[model samples]
Target: MRTLRFLLQKEFRQILRSRSLLISIILGPVIQLTLLPLAANFEVKKIAVAVVDHDHSTYSNKLIAKIYASKYFSGGTYHSSYEAANKMIEQNKADIILEIPQGFERNLVREGHEEVYVAVNAINGTKAGVGSGYLGAIVADFNQDVRLQWNQPGHFSEAPTIDVVNANWYNPFMSYFLFMVPGLIVSLLTGIGAFSASLNIVKEKEIGTIEQINVTPIKKHHFILGKLIPYWVLSMFVFTIGMLVSRFAYGIVPVGNIGLLYGFLSAYLITLLGAGLLISTYSDTQQQAVSLAFFFVLVFNMISGVFTSIDSMPDWGKALSYLSPMSHFAAVMRMVVLKGSTFHDIQPHFIAIIILGIVFNTWAVLNYRKTT
Candidate 1:
């Protein structure tokens, strides 16, 4: 314990004395946490639409008005022909085209049916799908309105209606920022704990400082713990900054127990730092360490259910994802923040990280050789 304390002091002093690195380490992530949530949003909006209206009828104009009025749509300029509207899609000026056929109102009023053509630009699949879906819903709502107005009380027979009352539990407004902020925080934290920590240790080796430590009478675990401790504390400080940004800048407040989130974070950081040290133990240079660290963290981020769902992945991918510490941390953050998950509810995640901590630290300790 005494030896670990002295080593930790050395590590902290080294980190603090470097003003440039210290600023970059602390300020860079703060900027990311503050700005990323604003741009990394998943909600698709302001989709450009084009309309081909051959009817020029009352209902057709009303439908066009409704499409343009929606929050999801913009710039639904009326065109002369379907071919002209299709040109807008090709030029990327419009994401989707709504073609209202001639005699549309007459067909709907007299025959009770008419087909309105919808053409979506599949170049950007997600935007196309969401924009088209939004248009389809508005058209359906318009159909319901027109049908009710045209039909008298005795002309229509009522059927059973199934209304879905969608209650968005944690995020009432379904703000994508609420869901994404926690995951982004975890991602930033992981990069700091893993990539930056590994780079730190390798930097010591590059400067011949690690050689001086290796010659001392310190226990292997003591040396490892010393390397891990300073960064561990700094990680918590960074985490506090991120949480503050999440709350004040983005209006994100975790609904779960803050203590529980901290407990999980403490466990997760230990394992991540250990993995970083394990990489540094084998790496000869800081470049090698940073490259390895970046590769691993990037892979973990891609597979960690941050931007996408894990359940949507294939069987092999899911199995591999479980091995990543990031997957568990991301899951824990979302579960606690969004669902208010309890300790018992997150047993599997907590245990997985602890187990990972043991494995990685043990590997690092064994790999770290002290030469006389």
Candidate 2:
């Protein structure tokens, strides 16, 4: 206990003395939590469109007007021919082109149907799909309006209609930031814990101080605990700050018990910091430790359901996500924060993280050599 206390003191002092480390610990979470949710939005908006209006009739003009008034579309370009509209697409000026044929309105009135051509730029597939979907919705609404205006009562009376009422649970407004901020907090904490812990032993190696401590009577577990504890405390501090940012900036308040969230965080940090120490044990220099830590953290974050849902992934990917501590952490975070999940609800994830902590820390301790 006495040896561990002194070692902890040394670790804290070392961390406090480094200006870059101090600034990163204090400011990185603030900046990331403040800005990332605002920037990393999934809602597609302001799609550029081009119109080739060969009909040039009242109904066609009205259809174009409806699209122009929509918030999803940027003001469109009008072209006389398909060639001209195609040129606009080639110049990267438009995402979609809507072509109305010559007899569009005439055919709709006489034959009660007309065909319209839509061309979308596939360069950005997501933008193209979403933009075209918005355009199709506008055209559908226009058709319904035309049918009502015509009021050919017996013509369409037998058609079936189904109305859908969408209710978004946990997030009623579907605020992307609400969903993203919790995951971002988990990701940031993981990076801070892993990077800081991984660099501790390697930094000593780079500065020739490690040889001095290695010669002492200190046990490997004591040294490892001393290194891990301080950063674990610091990571919790950062987590608190991130939660506060989520509350004030984005108006997010966890629907579940805040204490439960913290409880899981404590366990989750063990796994993360243990992984860092494992990396540190393998790396001989700060540069090597950082490279290895970055690689693992990036892979963990990518597979952790941070930006996308794991349920949507393939069988192999879903199976692999269980191996990532970040994956369990992210799931527990959303379950507790958004869904108000109880301890029983998160038991599986909690057990998974604890097991990971034990496995990783045991590996790190076993690999750490006092002589080398």
Summarize candidate 1's per-residue lDDT along 1-372 as a digit string, tens digits: 888778888888988998986776689778998888889877889898888899999989898888878999976677999999988888889888888999998998899899999989998888988888898889989988887888766787856567668898888899888899899999999988897678776787899988887887889999888889888998998888888888998788888898999999999999999999999988989989989998999999999999889999999989989999999999999999888999999999999999999999999999988873
TM-score per candidate: 0.97, 0.96
User: How does each model score on lDDT?
Assistant: 0.89, 0.92
lDDT tens per residue, model 2, 1-372: 999999999888988899999899979899988988888888888888899999989999999999989999986899999999999999999889999999999999999899899999999988998889998999999999998889777776747779788999999998888889999999999889899999988888889888998999999999999999999999999999999999999989999999999999999988899999999989999999999999999988888999888999898888889999999999999999899999999999999999999999999999999874
Model 1 clashes, total count: 0
Q: Lowest lDDT 10-mer window, candidate 1? A: 152-161
Best candidate, lDDT? 2
Model 1 misplaced stretches (Cα beyond 4 Å): none
Candidate 2 Cα deviation (angstroms), residue 64: 1.4
**CA lDDT of 179 in candidate 2?**
88
